[model samples]
Target: MALPDPNTSWPPKPWDEAYKVYAESETWRVGDADAIHEFYRGERPAATHRRDGELYEGGVVGWVSSKFWGRPVPPGQNRTRLHVPAPADVASLASASVFSNPPELRFTDKQSKNTIDRLELIGNSDQAHSTFNTMGELKSVFGASVLVSEWDTEIADHVWLSAYGADVALPEFRKGKLVAVTLWTEYRDGNEYYRHLERHAVGAIEHALYLGTADKIGQRIPLQDRDETAYLATLVNENSVILTGIDRLTASYNMNLPTWAWRKKGALANAGRSDFAQLYPLFDALDEAYSSWMRDLKLGAAKAVVPQAFLETLGRGRGASFDIDRELFVGLNTPGNPDGDKIEQVQFEIRTEEHEATTTELWRMIYRTAGLGTRSVDKDTGRQLTATGELLQDDDKEATRGKKILYDKRAIAEQLAVALELDGKLFAGKGGGQFAPPEVRFPDSAQVDPEKQARTIQYLSAAGAISVWQSVKMFNPDWDDTAVGAEVNRILAEKRAAAAMVPDPATFDGGDPTQDPNNPDNQGGNPDGGQ
Candidate 1:
């Protein structure tokens, strides 16, 4: 399992099942009509195909199609279908709830000023917060995601991180801690699939290129065989091993939820569960509900069942038309028949109330099942709600966000520590501190009112309950000790300057001519108001 063997079954054993799960999740994440239909149709034991009577492709026989997305109709009839983007929407909501305000990142080693500076520089350069926000959404979609930090001097001076989804990332863990991972990228040349697999172990990264089919890893080939993977050949040895100077793996796999991949056995016992894992059926049903709503509208369109004589004939070779807009029509000279003579309007009743209720019920279930309580819905009225409203009121969503933040804190810290370690070893003098994980803190879900917070801090400081230093920290939680000290000093210096500007009470005349030595109204009196 160190490196993929030639002509071997790809994604061996339990991974095959895991891949199936990933594929299904991927389909939902995409939220595409055709792709979802195609994926779901393939899942059926047998496709039931029926021809569209004398209309579609000259009534040619073909394989089964989707009832929702690929429903066929007669020659000129319109097909109605709808797809709800609930999966992506839920994933994005989960991501934004956790990462709307970037987590506070800090290294514990204060003495390693150089290391701190290096870490800060790397974080800023790599836009770690935004990258994590993106990864949060991916993990929500795929159940788990991987972060790989590498020191590539050619790419950038500092260590950079790469994110991989559960589909392509093959991870190995020991007691729930990631020990190794193999990440692969697939490229398709016509029908052939070419994969570049890179495995990250403790002290080395191994790479191999495979010329494979869509479903099989065919054989190992030279990296130079493909233009995309050619650069890897120059970076790795002939054995395709690149020695990492650090003693730890550069990759960390983070799960979105605490639910383990119990379906998989052995050392890879604990894996993350996707938000959409058991909710696929609900999502499908949701689409069906909305689609039915639209279908009702389509089917309920008003129509006039006109007699054959009523249709105005266009000139020879052209079709006839029932011109409802016409002011007048030529009289039918033929004898009138009771059934065929009278025009009858036909319109199916649209179940607007029923559809809306069903959709609302389904959405409520979806919100709860996804751990988002009444997300964007008024619980009482079942109406749309604002994002701010949801944030303030949705306790379930906040709890979910809190759990995700806690999970990500450890993974992010570990990966950052690994990055620092890699930087210390790969680029010797760049970073000088101890390579240890930092304390990661996410912003509180319910943010305190800033004005109220400031007032409380001022009151506490004035009452002597908290020192000026502590007050400064309360106002700016993310500030380092140096910044806080600088702020405290500035405040004290300003207070001293104001005090120096005030006139001394002893020197003040107090509007009394007798007390003023310069006043001519009376003889000079004692300066202490002893006149």
Candidate 2:
């Protein structure tokens, strides 16, 4: 099929219509994406809800609900509530667990010498580790992230890899395979609109369209008001075109497994669902409870009682007339007035124990919903657990959620396969060799006790239940197969050297020492003496 013309109609009438439908379907999801972004930025929905005049009726004036009227009512204050660190904590924990150490790439054929180098080149080039780390964080925040790979001639290695959030790239799927992808980019130069689009369709040449509301001389104008000549010139001669590109077609892949939706069976179902989203309600509740507790404390601390007569004598300025730190004196027209002798202070106590308990419970709920164990918090005091304990708790949970990490491993393997295929097709002349789909290895998330594991491996090795190589591997999980083989060779060399140092009895005289000791050499004492 011929490519669509930019001059006749860009974005096509049907595409525009479809985009409208797609955008409409994604309205709520877009909102969810925004919320997820806010969450990552430490902004909680509770902050918005607790803002004055938002969910409340008459702003701060009508905040006195009947149930809270008698109590110290906390008015809805902007930015007063603490946005619980649940989102950030969960994201950090997940990212740390997923990529605490860099992943390993293994090839099925051990003789494929270039496999490791190629994998390393791609992984280390273009800041891939940082990009992957960000992707892990994105997965925790937005439920998904995307990996985009392409060959750029201008780049140092010619392989360009990038990670994108869920907002910009849209994948079109046919059956289970990705058929096409649309990437959108926008920018502004002064008052001009610059929009670029790259549409990659399977088995077809990739198309690039750049539209700007500026003339050739850089005069700003409305897109529709631009003349036909200017538009046609912009379409044809303004940008570079590629007739042949890599054969794999799609340049991007969504790095998330589609196990669940943003919300359960709704318009936003297609959107990415975040673990933080599940704990949003808990965070909001905690914030509200803490805010109320603070308000009560403030009100209780400021509570005081004043006499009506004193107020009248001071002309309603009694508060300014008396110093709280000094003794207050009230004068009466009469010589001695017992009523003005003393003023009583109102006493009110805050149920701090109850507030602390409630806050602790909320924190526990947040950690639990985020897939962090309850022991993630201190069981006794409800404070954050120790770092080592937290890590252990995360490891336990990750062990149970091994399926999730496995999916990540598989997804990354598939992506690397695609990248390798593209590399072979486009950059094979640059010393990039073809490779089979490599096995991906993630760090062991269930590593509870390394010392105990090492001891167990040692015992097994001593018992001849496992090979020395296997024991070495168990002790050093980060070592690849080649490294393990090298280590085994090194140990064997050491053993041979040690054996060579000590001569056996049979080899002492260059003969079997166990042979008859009465022989001439064995009876040398008498034979040599007689000689």
Highest-lDDT candidate: 1
Candidate 1 residue-pair clash tally: 0
Query: Model 2, 492: alpha-carbon shift in Å?
Result: 18
Record all residue pairs in model 1 with backbone atoms less than 3 Å apart, i.e. clashing.
Answer: none
Candidate 1 weakest lDDT stretch, 10 residues: 55-64
lDDT tens digits by residue: candidate 2, 348-420: 6887988988988887777776665666456578465566776676665776346557656655666676676
After superposition, candidate 2 runs with Cα above 4 Å error: 1-79, 110-115, 124-126, 186-195, 203-244, 249-252, 255-272, 300-348, 379-396, 421-430, 446-531
